[model samples]
Target: MEILTGSHERAVTTMALDGRLDALEAGQLRGILSETIERGDVNIAIDLSAVDFVDSAGLAALVKGMKDARQAGGDVKLVAPKSADAMRVFELTRFDRVFEMASELSSLVEKW
Candidate 1:
């Protein structure tokens, strides 16, 4: 998988995750997000649009990233996801509220 980094609303650091986000890759994902947070980013957005799969470990990584960001007065959000099954995980965990799920970059920009 590859991470495409960009900026949204000028300040929000957006990381677009691609490929699988299962146990095998969750650690990498966590590391990337953690590094992003450590870089002093206060606003982060993860674009899961290109991610084809997500497992519980991946979800936990996302949660961990969110927690880390929040601890530093930052926030992490998830962009719109096309995988219905994976999306269910967010709803079940109430992460739908924890992370701002946007339909597109514009949706998030409008809110920001």
Candidate 2:
């Protein structure tokens, strides 16, 4: 998986993810989020539009990132997950309820 980071005016850091989010990539996700949080960028938007697949470990990594962000007085939001298989994982895990989701980055930025 590849993670690209950028910031918005609302102090929201957007991480655009590409490729599969599996066990091997889970740690990279965590590290990216950790670095963002440590930089005092607590509000995050994860752009999963390019992510075709995600496994249990990837979900765990997302959960961990959200928890860490919240603890820092911020939050993590999911955006534009176009893959059906990837969305199914979130649905099956009921993570759809746990994390705030948006169809576009603009919506999340506006809400935040």
Candidate 3:
């Protein structure tokens, strides 16, 4: 997996993930989110539109990030996954209702 990071004026950290988000990449993603929050940028926009797949470990990492960010007085907004398989994971797990999601990154960033 490839992770690209960027920042917004609203103190939101944007992370775009390319490729599959699975077990092997879960730890890395968790660490990145932790570091971003540690740096005081707790509002995060995670663009999953480019991601091809997402497994349970990947979802766990995202949940951890969301929880940590919320506790830090911010939130983690997800850019709705373009892949049906990835989207299904969120739906099946009922995480779609738990997270604030948008189809576009710009939309989430604007909300932040």
lDDT of each: 0.83, 0.91, 0.94
Leading candidate by TM-score: 3
- For model 1, the superposed segments whose C-alpha errors exceed 4 Å read none
Instruction: Return the TM-score for each candidate structure.
Output: 0.89, 0.96, 0.98
**Ranked by TM-score, top first:** 3, 2, 1
Q: How close is candidate 3 to the true structure, as a TM-score?
A: 0.98
Per-residue lDDT of candidate 2, residues 1-112 (tens digit): 7899999998899889988999999999998889889989999999998899999999999999999999999999998579998888999989999999988888988899
Return the clash pairs for model 2, or none.
Answer: none
Candidate 2 lDDT trough over 10 residues, lowest sum: 79-88
Cα distance off (Å), candidate 1, residue 90? 1.3
lDDT of 2: 0.91
Which 10-residue span in candidate 3 carries the lowest summed lDDT? 103-112
lDDT of 3 at 110: 88
User: Per-residue CA lDDT of candidate 3, range 1-112, in tens?
Assistant: 9999999998889999989999999999999999999899999999999998999999999999999999999999999889998898899999999999999999889877
Q: Go through the candidates in order and give the C-alpha RMSD of each one to the true structure.
A: 1.5, 0.8, 0.6
Q: lDDT order of candidates, best first?
A: 3, 2, 1
